[model samples]
Every structure is written in structure tokens, then in C-alpha cells.
Target chain A: MRQNRFVEKSIEKLLFVAAAIATISVALITIFVFRSGLPAMSGYGFANFLFGADWSPGNGEYGILALTAGTLAVTFLALLIGIPTGVCCAVFLAEILPKRAAAVFKFAIELLAGIPSVVYGFFGLIVIVPIISEHVLPLWQRVNPDAQTTGLSILAGGFILAVMILPTIVSISENAISSVPQDYREASLAVGANKRETIVRVLIPAAKSGILASIILGMGRAIGETMAVMVLTGNVAMLPKGILDPVATLTGTIAMEMSYAGPTHQEALFGVGIVLFVIILILNLAAQAIARKMGAVGRE
Target chain B: MNRKLGDISFYGIVLILSLATLAILIVIIAYVMRQGLPHISWEFLSQSPEHMGREGGILPIIVGTVFVTLLALAIATPIGVGAAVFFAEYSKEGRVVQVIRTFTEVLAGIPSIIFGLFGFAFFVVFMQMGWSILSGGLSLSLMILPTIIRSTEESLKTVPLSYREGSLSLGATKWETTVKVVLPCCRKGILTGLILGIGRAVGETAVLYLTIGGSIRIPTSLFDPARTMSMHMYMMTAEGISREKSFATAALLIVIILIVNSIANFISNRMKGAQ
Candidate 1:
């Protein structure tokens, strides 16, 4: 009996140890990044680093204003393109498509999500960039012929990011729509409402929070992406004059410089990471709150 | 009536949009193959990277990525599933388990770049491991552990309660019943989690870029710095190399992940049938 009791105690202890280790991993990382990034923060002070306009690592001045702007620009552009399309795709799958076909489409999107970011970067480089340079850029240039940038602009990067985030938004929004229940759809249809009207007015309004949460999740992915945008964005750390101009992002800045960055340079890069992480953390918290609200009202 | 026509049009739009999703996969595959296949060669697969005029292959990068991911899965699977077992079987009350579960969920939601930053700061710097493979694998193990545990818990929950009752009736202890009956019943689900974890580890790029310093040559040991295939592709593309080699490597990685995923799905389905 004593031996059995000992074994049970050990099992509980083991569980505690495992959970502790997991949490420690995340915590230690946050602390260490802050520690390493301290030197740069001291050197430039927070206001200058955050608000200054130039980012020339060679001459010892490092301002992230343009990089932050570029990051926000690409993220906003991606959300703009991906949200409407993803919602339409989700609604169509949930309300209109045949079951088997919808299953195939969902499977395809999931697989697309599974593909590595490196592969996405490779694909964008070979296929998307050329299409932009050869066809899209010239058309835009016709309006502004003297525009110095030919390709590798924020628009191209934003388009690629939209493609990457599409699957995430579609899947999440599909679940939102599906959770609306058959009874609601049936009641709307029984009241002489056409399928389109029922979907737009009845189904969408019912799951608005979840659909909004899906778009927020897409924003997280867009802001966090590195390799694809890094490859296509031309890495010029200046605020984009227009959507067609070149720019850099926080993720891209860290990735491009982390390897060769000097002590101050490396610390500045870590600061970029900290800023990016905080943004994503806040976004995720908002999404989780929205999701919870959605569930509570959904039950009611 | 106009309403009836509107219903038909809605259905038509849904069909077209749904088919378009599948069309994306077709377009991606077509693009990858068109750009990648012609350049694939045995030498390209076998050789190492080159800087100036030399022709390079992906031998080291492929091996390094596989080795690191396999090592991480080895360490993470037992602990993750063990925690899941404890939560599902042993936890009688509420708040502590709820907190632990929430933490795991938050960990899963944290971006890979954050994981990379954490790995870099803690594993690489605080631990003084100096961008070695072991540090990187440890970081990745933590990153994927949440996914494995959640999926395992879901699968364990699906195992019918009757099996546990039957085992207890036969004079078995809780541990014995879990080990013998419940574990066997949920083997397919557990395997699915492992497979998904593997896919995440194999495809991961951002974390590796920070934790594992990009060195193209083969690592002599786990403590050595290594470059993964994804990292290699990132480096190559960033350097503005011609698209041929980069595309070939990308295609190769995609094919490898597809095969692994399909095989995993097949095994799990077979296990489901056997049970």
C-alpha cells in the first residue's frame, strides 16, 4: 500500500515538473531578450529609437520609424485583401456549396497552411515577382511613369501575405458560420428570405464577432511573417511614399540583420522582436476575448 | 420569383468560390513543378552549398533539419503526452488544471518569431550554448509541445468510458487500465498529434534562423551550429541567387512534408480501423 502511494505521489510530482519546465521556457526567453536589448535602449533612449526617421546601421544611427510604418502598411494591406475574400469563401462553403466539394476545399486550404514559409518565399520569388515586374508594375507606372520603383514594392509583399493568411481566415470564419446552427438558417428561409439575404443579414450578423476575430488572427500572421516578405520586399528601410515604393518591416529587419549585427545593432534587432511580440500578444488577447464573447452570446 | 433566382445564384457563387480554393492548390503545385523539376539533379541533392561560382547541393541542410526535428520530437512527446494523461485522468478538481491548460493554449498562440527571440535570448545567450543545434532543438520542443498535448488530450477524451469500467471490474488499477486499455484505444489519435508536431518542426523557419546559426557545412555533433533546409532557402533567396536552385530545394522540402503527412494519415486511419 505504501509503495503504491509513493508511485502516485511521484506521478503528480512529474506532472508538476513538466508544467514548470514548459512555462520556464517561455518566461526565460522574454527576460533574456529584454536583458540583451537593454544596452541599445540606453544608448539611444526610447523616444529617439522609436520616433527617429533614419535607420542607417553603418553610421551608428538606428531609427525604426520607417520599418514600423512599413510593417503596419503591409499588415493592413494584407488584411484588406484577405478578409473579404476569406469571408466570402467561408460563407459560400458554409451556406451554399455541396458537402463533398466543401470538404475538398477545406482540405486544400489546410494543406496550403501546412506548406513551409520558405517554399512560399521561393514561389513568390519565381512566379509572383515576375508577374509584378513585367505586367503589374508597368500598368501602375503608366499613371505615374517616372515612379522610380519598378517592382518589389509594398503591394507585391502585401499580395503574397494575403495569399499566406487566406487559409487561416477561411478556416476560422467557416467554423464561425457553421456554429450558427441550422435552425436559424431554416427560420430565415421559411420567412421568404432568399439564401443570399438570409446569409448576409441573418447568418453573418449572428457570428460577426467570430468573423472579426478571424480577421484579427489574419492580421497577426501578416505582421509576424518573415521569409516571404523578406525575400520580396527589397529591404530598403524607409517609409513607403506610396504602395508601389520599397520598404522594410520589423520581422524583416530582425532576420536581415541579426546574423551580422554588432553589439548595439543586435540589441536594436532584439528590440524589434520585442515590439513585434508585444503587438501580436495584444492582438491575440483581443481575439481570445472576442471568441469568448462570441461563445457566451452563441449559447444565449 | 426573384427570391428563388437569388437562392440559385448564391449556390452558384458558393460552388465557384469553393472550387477556387482547390484551384489554389493546383496553381501552387503547377508553379512549383514548372520552376523546380528541370533543375533537380543527383549532384544537386548530394553536394553542399557554394559561395561564388561553385555548384551546391542540399545534403547537409536536409540532414541537419531532420536530425534536429527528430531529436525535438523524441524529447517533447513523452512529457507532453504525460501531462495530457495527468490532466485527463488524474485531475479531480478545476482551477489548477484550467490554468495549466490556458498556459498551454497561450504558448500555442505565441508567434514562432517570439519563440525564436526567446530561444535566442535564453537558450543561445543565457545558457551559453552559442547557437548550437541542441539549444535550437530544446527551443523547438517547447514550441511544439502544446500542440502535441492538446491533440493527445482530445484523443484520450474520445476513448469510451466503458473500457475503463471494464478494466476496473477485472481488478486493474487506474494506471494499469490507462496503460493497457485506454492507451491502445487512442493510439491513432496520439499518433496524429505526433505527426502534426513533426510537420510543424520540419517546416519551422523563423525560430531556427535565430537559434541555429546559419552554417552550411555539416555539423560534427549536436553541440555544433547547423543550418536547416528552410534556413538555407531563406539565405539563398535573400542573397538574390538565381531562382532555379532555390525553387528546387523548396519543391524537395514540399514533397518530403507531403509524403510524411500522407503516411501519418494512412497509419492513423489504419489504427482506427484496427481498434
Candidate 2:
């Protein structure tokens, strides 16, 4: 019996070691990125490297303003395009759709989410980019033909990102909407509200906190999406002058240059990564706070 | 009347958008099939690209992706399972376990590109490994570690404490009991976690793009640079002329993912049946 206790304690010890390893590994990664990025910090100095716009590797000037601008622009555009659609889809699945149909739709959304990011980039490059070139670009040209490059533009990247994050938003929002107890809907309906009125006025308000959390999470996904934007967004390291112009996001810059970049350039990329990390961390914390508050509200 | 019209528009909007999500999938699949179906051939699957401009086969990528993923899983599985065991079984619900739990959650939430950046900076830069399969695999192992830990921990929690107590009463050592009774019972759930981890590793592009240079040639060694299937697809599509080749690659990847996913679903269903 004593031997068995010893054996169990040892197994437990091993588990602790494993968990510690996982935490240490993540910390090591973040540390290494910053450590490698030190040269760029020394060379360009912190303020100039971040605030400068040009990212010409040949000239040894590594400003990330352009990439930062690109990442924010594309991510914001994706949110603008995706949020309304995602919320509506959530509402339709949670409220409007028949139960059987909602399940199928939910499964479909999960499948979409499961599709690799590379595949999304591949399809976007082949199908979406060309469409933008032939139709969307021409329409844009009619409005502003004097606009810069055509094929690979911010609009192109943003549209693809919106598609990429749609599943994430819809699935999370669906979870939030469904978690609203049925009694809430019934109570609203009993108060002389119709189905549409009950959902719009009562269910959504009740689920608002959770739904907001999902949207914030979706925004994090949009900002962090690397492969899709890397391929579709013309690798131009310039601040986007117009939605139709080429631009590079923070993620795109890191992925595109990390392979061939010199030590300083690589560090510069890591510096951008650090910034992206902090933003994502902030976003996640905000989401968690909102989710907790929503949980409290749900209980009440 | 005004309120009714507003509600009608809202419902109409919801219907249109919900259906639009479904429409997006159909459009994408249709487009892929239209462009890729003609190009997929058995020969293409078995062969390699002839030159820079010619239509290429994904044999190297298929081999490379599998090799790296399996290698990374070999490294990740034991450690991930150990961590899960510790979190679920060994550690009391205390500050350290909570911190570890939060850490894993943070890791899971991290963007894959950052993992790539770290791999490039650390393995390629500091370790002086150059761009190789080993670095890519290591990075991938890190990326999938949380998935394994989370899933395994959940499985461990599902394991009844009575089983452990029963084994203890029988004079079995805790280690022996855990290995004999607890692990075997949760094997199906642990296996499910592993399957999902493989899926994440296989589908990854950003991390591999940094750690493994997109070399389309067959890799002769783990230390050598090799391209993955997704990377090949990205390169082809980027070049813009190799649409057919790229489409075929996407189709092939989709097929592989579907097989993995279906197997995962099957195992999960079997687990449910057994329970």
C-alpha cells in the first residue's frame, strides 16, 4: 500500500514537470523573439524603428509604421465586414432557424473554421484576387482610377480575412446566443412580443456581453491571421493610401522577411511581433473580463 | 406599422447573412473543384515538380509534412500527456496549477505567426540550425502542445477517482494503478487529442514558412530544408500562373484533412458508444 502511494506521488510529480515545461516553453519563445530583436533595437533605436514608415531592407532602414498601419487597416476592415454578418448569422441560428437546420448550419461553420488558413489564402489568391482585379478594381477605378496598384490590395486582403474570421465569429456568437435561457424568450413573448421583437429586444440584450466578447475575440483572430494576408496582400511595405492599394500587415512582414532577413531586420520583425503580442494579450484580457461579467449577468 | 417593418428588415437581414455563410463554403468548394479536379492525377501525386515553371507534384510535400508532423508528435505527445496528468491528477487546485492552466490558455490563444517568429529567431538564429525540418518540427511541437495538454487533462478529469481508490485498495502502487487502470481507460480521449494535434500541425503554414524554407525538393534528412504541401500551394498561387497545380494541391490537402477529421469523429463516436 505504501509502495502504491509512492508510485502515485511520482506520477503526479511527472505531471507537474510536464506542465512546467509547457509554461517554460512559451516563455522561452517570447524571450527569444525579443532577444534576437535586440540588434534592431540597438541599430535603429526603439522610437525610430517603430515610428518610421519605410521598411527598405537594402537601405538598412527598418521602420514598421507601414506594417502596423497595414495590419490595423486590414483587421479593422475585416471586422467591419464580418461583425454584422456574424451577429446576424448567430441570431438566425440561435433564434430564427428551426432546430435541425441550426445544427447543420453550426456544423458547416465549424467545418469552415477547420479549413486550413493556407487553403483560404490559396482560394483567395486564385478566385478572390482576380475578381477584385477585373470587377472590383474597375469599379474602384471609376470612382478613383488614379488609385495605385490593382490586383493585390488592402481591400483584397481585408475581404479574405473577413472570410477567414467569419467562422470564428459565427461559432462563438452562436454559443453566446444559445446560452441565453429559453425562458427569457418565453417571458418576452408572454409580454405580448412577437418572435422578431422578442429576439431583437430581449434575447440579444441578454446575450450582448457574451456576443461582444466573441466579436473582440474575432478581432484578435483577424489581426493575427498571417498566411492568408501574406499571400494575398501585395507584399508592398507601404502605408495604404487607399483601400485598393497594396499594403503589408505586421504578420505579413514577419513571415515574409524572417527567412532571409539579417539579424537586425529579423529583430525588427520580432519587435513588431512583441507589439502584436501585447495587443492580443490586451484584447484577450478584455474579452475575459467581458465574459466574466456576462456570466455574472446570466446567473442573475 | 413602422416597428413591424423594422422587425421584418431585421429578420430578412439575419436570413440573408446566415445563408451567406453557407453560400461562402459552396462557392469556395465549387471554385476549388472547378479549377482543381482536372489537374489532380495519380501521377502528379507520385511525382515531383520538373522545373520552376512546370506543373509540380506534391509528393515531396506529402512526405515532408507527414515526416515533420510525426516527428513533432513524437516529441510533443509524452510531454503534453505528462503535463495534462500533472494538471488533472497530481496537482492540487492551487496557485501553481492555476498559473499553469492560464499559461496553457495563453499559449493556445497565441497567433501561430508569433510562434514562427520565435522559431526563426531562436532555432534558426541562436541555435544556428539554419532552415531545417528539425526546427520546424520543434516549433510545431510547441504550437500543438497546448492542444494535447488541454484535451488530455479533460480526459484525465473524466477518469473516476474510484478507479484509483480501487487500485490503491488492491495494494497496487499509484504509478502502476495510473498506468494500468486510469490511462488505459482514458486512452480513447487522449487519442482524440493526438488526432486533433496532428490536424493543427499538418494545416499549419505560417510557422513552417519561417522555420523551413519553402524548398520544393525532396528532403534527404531532417536537417535539410523542405517545402510542405500548404507552402507549395501558397508559392504556386503567389506566382499566379500555376493555378492548376496550386488547385490540385489544395484539393489534395482538403482530402487529407477530411480523412483525418473523419477518423477523429469516428474515434469520438466509438468512445461515446463504449461509454
Name model 1 segments beyond 4 Å from true: A296-300, B1-19, B50-56, B264-275
What TM-score does model 1 score on chain A? 0.94
Q: What TM-score, computed on C-alpha atoms, does each candidate reach?
A: 0.92, 0.92
Per-residue lDDT for A137-211 in model 2, tens only?
A: 777778886865657888889988887888777877777888899899888989899988887888888888888
TM-score, prediction 2? 0.92
Best by TM-score: 1
Candidate 1 structure quality by residue, lDDT tens digits, B1-275: 87778778766766665566567667887788777777778988888877621357878887889888987899899888887888778776578765665566556666777788778888788789988898789889988898788778778887889999999899877787888998887777888888888888888888899998877778879888998878877777777665677778777777767776676667665765665
> Model 2 off-target regions past 4 Å?
A292-300, B155-185, B266-275
Question: What tens-digit string does per-residue lDDT give for candidate 2 at B42-105?
Answer: 9788888867526657788888898889978998999999888777666778887777766676
- Which 10 residues in a row give candidate 1 chain A its minimum summed lDDT? A291-300
Question: DockQ of each model against the real complex?
Answer: 0.56, 0.63
The alpha-carbon deviation from the true structure for residue B230 of candidate 2, after best TM-score superposition, in angstroms, is 0.6
Best by lDDT: 2
First chain TM-score for all predictions = 0.94, 0.93
